[model samples]
Target: MKNWLLHILVNAIAIIIVSFVFSSVEIEGFIGALIAALILSILNAIVRPILVILTLPITVLTLGLFLLVVNAITLAMTDALLGSTFEIAGFGMTIIAALVISLLNLVLNSFIKD
Candidate 1:
């Protein structure tokens, strides 16, 4: 429970930071941001592995560059599901947002020691 709550908090911060960094992405408010983060986490956990496997060939062919596209797609899907709460405008913006969010998640998780 504590870990889950920490995850939510970290995601909320990531969303806020990403939205601030990119004009194309927007997080409406705290609750909306939380919901978007939760949805994104679920999508990343469940769907991302299958996507990675199916796209392995392309991923290897591109020397791992295809991972950016995968991340953008995941962000776009989260935006679509969360409606206006999370709005990722285009592929470029999605990629930028994803990079920022992933970095933020890494930094937050690093401090948790678990």
Candidate 2:
């Protein structure tokens, strides 16, 4: 539970950074960002694996590059579900935003001992 909360916090930071770095992505406020982050985490943990399995052939053909598109779609899905709380404007921005969020989450999670 603590680890999950920590992950959520890290994701919130990532969302803020992504929103600032890319005009296409936006979080209305800290609360919205937090909610979006939590939603993103849930989606990644649950839905993403199913998606990867369903798209295994394409993923292999693209040498895993298609995962980026999958990430973008997830981000867009988060935005759609959360209404204006999260917004990813375009495919290009989605790629950049997803990469940034992933890197940030990895770095932040590393600092967590548990």
Candidate 3:
């Protein structure tokens, strides 16, 4: 439970930071960020693996660069799910924001133990 909560917190912080950093990414408020983070967490856990597998050929062909697109897809999914509260404009913006979120997650996960 503690680890789970920390994970959510990390996501919330990452989303907020990304939104602040990118004009195209807009998170309404802390609550909105939290909700977006939760949905993104769910999507990443359940959908990311399938997407990575489904697009493995492209991922391999691109020498793993296509994984960034998959991450952007998940980010776009979060925006679509959250609607106005969490809006990410354009594919490029989504990809950049996703990259920031991924880096933040990586750093936070390193500090958090399961």
TM-scores, all candidates, are: 0.91, 0.93, 0.93
What's the residue-level lDDT of 65 in candidate 3? 94
Off by more than 4 A, model 3: none
lDDT of 2 by residue, 1-114 (tens): 988898899899989987888777888999999999889989999888998999999999999999988988788789889987788887788888888898988898889897
Clashes of each: 0, 0, 0
In angstroms, how far off is 28's CA in candidate 3?
1.1
Alpha-carbon lDDT of model 2 = 0.88
RMSD of 3: 1.2
- lDDT per residue (tens digit) for residues 18-83 in model 1: 888778888898888889888888898898898999999999999998988888788899988988
Say which candidate scores most in lDDT. Answer: 3
Judged by lDDT against the true structure, how good is candidate 3? 0.91
Looking at model 2, which ten-residue stretch has the lowest summed lDDT?
84-93
Q: lDDT of model 3 at residue 21?
A: 83
What lDDT tens digits, residue by residue, belong to model 3 across residues 15-106?
99888888888999999999999999899999999999999999999999999999999989989998899998899988888889999999
Evaluate candidate 1 by giving its C-alpha RMSD to the native, one decimal. 1.3
